[model samples]
Target: MPRNRATASPLFVPRKATRTQQRVARAEFAKARTKARAAQAPSRRREHEGADPELQPSYPASGRPGPASARGGRLRLPKHRMTTAVAGGAYPFLAEAGLGAEGIFIGRDLHAEGSFCYDPFALYNSGRIEGFTNPNAILCGVIGMGKSALAKSIATRAIAHGYKIYVPSDPKGEWTGLAEALGGQTIALGPGLPGKLNPLDAPGRPTGVSEEDWTNEVRKRRLLLLASLAATVLKRDLLPMEHTGLDVALDLVVADAEATETVPLLGDIAHVLGNPERLDAALGDQAGGLGRAADDLAHAFRRLVHGDLSGMFDAPSTVAFDPAAPMLSIDLSRLGSSGDDTALVLAMTCASAWMEAALADPAGGRRWVIYDEAWRIMRHVGLLERMQQQFKLSRGLGIANLVILHRLSDLLSAGDAGSRGRVLAEGLLADCSTRIIYRQEPDQVQVSMSLLGLTGVEAQAIGALTRGRGLWKVAGLSFIVQHLLHPREKPLYDTDFRMTA
Candidate 1:
């Protein structure tokens, strides 16, 4: 049917329809198209500028800004609803901006599809991310999720940035190869092994400290080690009198070792603790009858000296500490493989103490202390307490601790809720400003969400993450990254050679 002439703005407009209606519709179309282009890539946005009269089309571009479609009906976009995450693919430019291209290049940001980089020290120093107050970080993932590879990548890449790596205790001994490859040192400690570590050894005084101050500092550290060992063995905290006894025993050992001009050994301290009379007399007029107080403490240290765990930490250290070493790790894979980890925990205590003493120097340059298999240590309050100190002092020491675990629930297993072990475990989690979570089993998603304070969506994302990918939460910001491996690093970081072969 032929119709009367229509107004430009509307198909059924009266003859009296004004030109303002047509101008208004065109104005709205231009405004909406401008907004759509604004969300596009910068390069795409620039395409709208400066048209060439020769090559430019005389008609408008596709999805033309007019009242109707070229098919003779009003233009309409077929409405479809989808999750923003799924829609992001069709709108790639609307993803996260990403944590800038600085520090160690980890891999690629899954959402942004851009390079991903991370450096705790760099991020802490930049002051870009608020709530990122500490340099410490924790990583959790189920087995085969590549958490170890990510950790190794951080350690290997960090070397180029003038940072030192220290694996205070390597349970699996896997880091031995990586440490050696980086031209670092690894001390394997076990029964009948030649390597020995004396936790009482004093680190060289820092440049500015006075001699007297260094002496006192060494004494304090030694006392703390003794108390921690006793606590772990006895399964309880030391009393004031027991603390006094340890203090007395350590002073006697230090005095004798310094007089002999020899390094102090754990056996020396254990020996003094065994003789309460000696500890009592050492205190002189200050105290007496302290022998009874130290009787139990003696048994605690005796395990490290003359018991099954002897020969590892009882003798003088075979190798001296190299302050400039790129990395240092103690291998305890062969030891404490039994069901009971008491012996392993004790060894970790002594080894960590030695490393902590060396790392006490603030000017040792930036360092990373990776506590691999940290879940094993979380059960003992004494270990957690000692580990807590490292985390608390990490910022001042210019050290970052990367604590790895199999799942977030590992923290819950530290102790019953409101218990000391639980408190320490939660405290450790609090101190870590960065948390990297790899793929998890379905049952683990709830634990990850509760412990890490992740939203339902984030929790869901974690359960579905594939290998070599993780959800990184820096400060309060979050990112999903696919951990890319280098060709050369594949051989070094691979832990699946046995199954693959």
Candidate 2:
């Protein structure tokens, strides 16, 4: 074996082999370390900025760009080069940018409110708010602050922008004028009004009933609805027994099956609850004599609903709109004075008709209903929440509601403090996505600012707004525009013709 040693090859002879083995070992170690570091790190996409990765970097789908093939002569980016805004910054210069004129703008502006009458187009297009983001909006201001005027102006602009509108007529008069101006129809409804027209009831064959009957019916239904709401409120706040005066009145009306029975109910309440002292005590000093009035109202409703005049509670009469018209106005002044029961009836009728029309024309363009002085009748009816809920379900149907109130606390009338009335209002406001808050007292300003999540400067802005000025915000948009006054229309109101813009 010793003699054959030279013939046997050496165990390790090549220098190149040794170097290659060391290099392979080092590379394997480095690869293992890299994988371990990756596993230890958090499994989330790096977030250097607060941007939503899934949202398209443009307006609505209507504004989306066409595919490369459809671009014709334009040079296109490679398939892999179509990076999203999520990648960190703006798209490349060569990228197809979309800045279409399809969206509504919302942000801070410096225009005065009354100016809308003169330059409605500019005021509407000033980019103070983006309607597409939040279709809902709140118009909050104190009494005589011209909240109604501003609401009307904004609605007009919305109409110009191809939107439909629904407004709860305060006292039934507002709708008539606005409808005429906007080329819309005015339908009245309440206790007796039939919101629909019937070929069966046309003049001759119709049993000698006049149009007054239709008007009277609307009045009765409105009274009943208000009575029901007020009764519910009193039962919760003032009734001493489980069987309230309202309950007794209802029982009598239902049992008697006669309109005259309601008078006795009214007489009973007027005789007993009409004692000013007792009513004042029951409603608290702030409430005044609302209790007695409520009692009277309850009896009146029962009588109207069950009497020979029962046609007064036959539902609502609808005024159809002509989509081709420029405007239409519903005159509630003809119905009656503002605070009277007649006004209440007319307003409720208009609201009922508007709601019915909106629901029926679901495929119509965007429609909005603006309610000015909403607190007037809202206290006696549950229509606020009902309309709000309906509007929520009506998104696809192009229906929306705009409610203008002097204060946020007025929502308490819908229920109680323990109830979610305020919360519901807040949710409704938030859903609306647009807000126009004008100058208000410090207390109201603070409340508005808090709800909208504004800072000190923004809060002060709302409080400092003047008659034609307001703070406007459009949800999902970055800017908050300051709105200015719109131009005054020639003879905004006329007694002879009703609403003459």
Candidate 3:
């Protein structure tokens, strides 16, 4: 009976089911598939999560993806092809990290695309630049190349920052207008001018200095001034007798002033030189040929006081040297017509002596002593020696000397090759760790390169620089700068008026 029922059921089974029966079958099939997926989910997760800790794939300490694994791996990146020139902009290795922005704003750095600035005092104090302990600088350029403009801009801009400027001698009178514009004073010294400076006058003593120390300093300065003047006029260093004679005469003049509490004049020293009796009394038997030896020295003093160089520094200063003033310029343009090298040297000597008095003050703060037309000043051996002395003591005196010249060859011309004068001149250049070179003649490039130790690139740049553009070498770093000028500063610093006119 069971076999017969099964056979009938199989044959009678409908090929198609009714709508309600089809819905129930579909629902049951979906429920069975969902149960199967749910059961497989944990197994798949465990396959990923159940790895042994020690055997798990390791990544580099940098956290970057490791080598490929069976499970997964990092996506591969395509190689990039680019020229070095295009890549250099993104990673600049040849660029110069310029001198940090500090001190005075001079101009823009052509290489670094930013402003350029220079302050020797700030640099020295900050110690940011190595091997540049000295605060001196040399600026060299041909005429109309903006050397003077740069000098004036530095001086004028420095005035606003409380640094005093002392232009010992302005032979061309170029600083007269600038001095007046800065609310500073310029003492015009020439044949007809009423200005007079006494080289022997005691300098203003620094505070905390004893009277004895002050007196000794005054005597020392006066002795050096007189000796330097004599040597410059004679075109030779002073002999032992001349030195002794000068010492005796300076001592007497200073002694007389100390006794009378008055300032001595250059004529006073000349008078003592002419009269040996006073020196003999002071030296007692040690004054051998002192008077006779001083004849040339006396005559040199006479030339300064009552002779050709008279009326400028012959007597006591008619104008007071107010050290409180922001700037002081001695205009020697009047003596330019004289064409007397000795006279200019004497004027510079006296002006330097006068400034030394103010510079003695420890509280004078930082100051700049600019030697414009430095080529002319370096020619005189005595003046060159004095400049060397000042440069050596610049840090102690809290002063910086800026020498402006036409070329480095000007220094070589100071004396014969290998001569002491030449050596001293070269030493001056060596001491100046900062050198600003403007456009130069093609012929001068060799000398510039040799003297400044410029690289081939820098040496070649010297001749191609335009007006107001300069190659600034600070310490050991190099930068090409375009000096900027304000509209108001144009009229003040313009040296091309003649051409413009």
> For every model shown, what is its TM-score relative to the native structure?
0.81, 0.49, 0.80
Show model 2 residue runs off by greater than 4 Å: 1-108, 111-133, 187-303, 306-350, 377-381, 412-415, 476-501
Each model's total of backbone clashes: 0, 83, 0
lDDT of each: 0.86, 0.48, 0.83
Clashing pairs in 3: none
lDDT of each residue in 1-501, candidate 1, tens digit only = 223233233334444546875555557666767787667647643674686757665544565544555666766799999764575556643364456777999998877778889888888889888899999999999998999899999999999888999998888999999999999999999989889898888898988999999988888888888888888888788999999988878778888988999988888888988897787777887755685888898889888888888898888889899988898989999785756888898899999999999999999999999999999998888889889998999998899999999998899899999998899999999999999999888999988888889977788889999999999988877888999999999999888988983
lDDT of 2: 0.48
> Which ten residues in a row are the worst by lDDT in model 3?
4-13
Per-model C-alpha RMSD:
12.3, 20.1, 16.3
- Model 3, position 492: C-alpha lDDT score: 88
* Model 1 misplaced regions, further than 4 Å: 1-94, 285-288
Residue clash pairs of candidate 1: none
Which regions of candidate 3 fall more than 4 Å away from where they truly are?
1-94, 287-291
Task: Using TM-score, rank the candidates from best to worst.
Answer: 1, 3, 2
Error of 2 at 37 (Å): 73
Q: Tens digit of lDDT per residue, candidate 2, span 226-293?
A: 34344433333334332344434433333343455322223233333334354455445553344544
In model 1, where is the ten-residue run with the lowest total lDDT?
1-10
Q: Write candidate 3's Cα lDDT for 87-175 as tens digits.
A: 54554423455667778899998877788888999889988777887899999999988998999999989988889998998988999
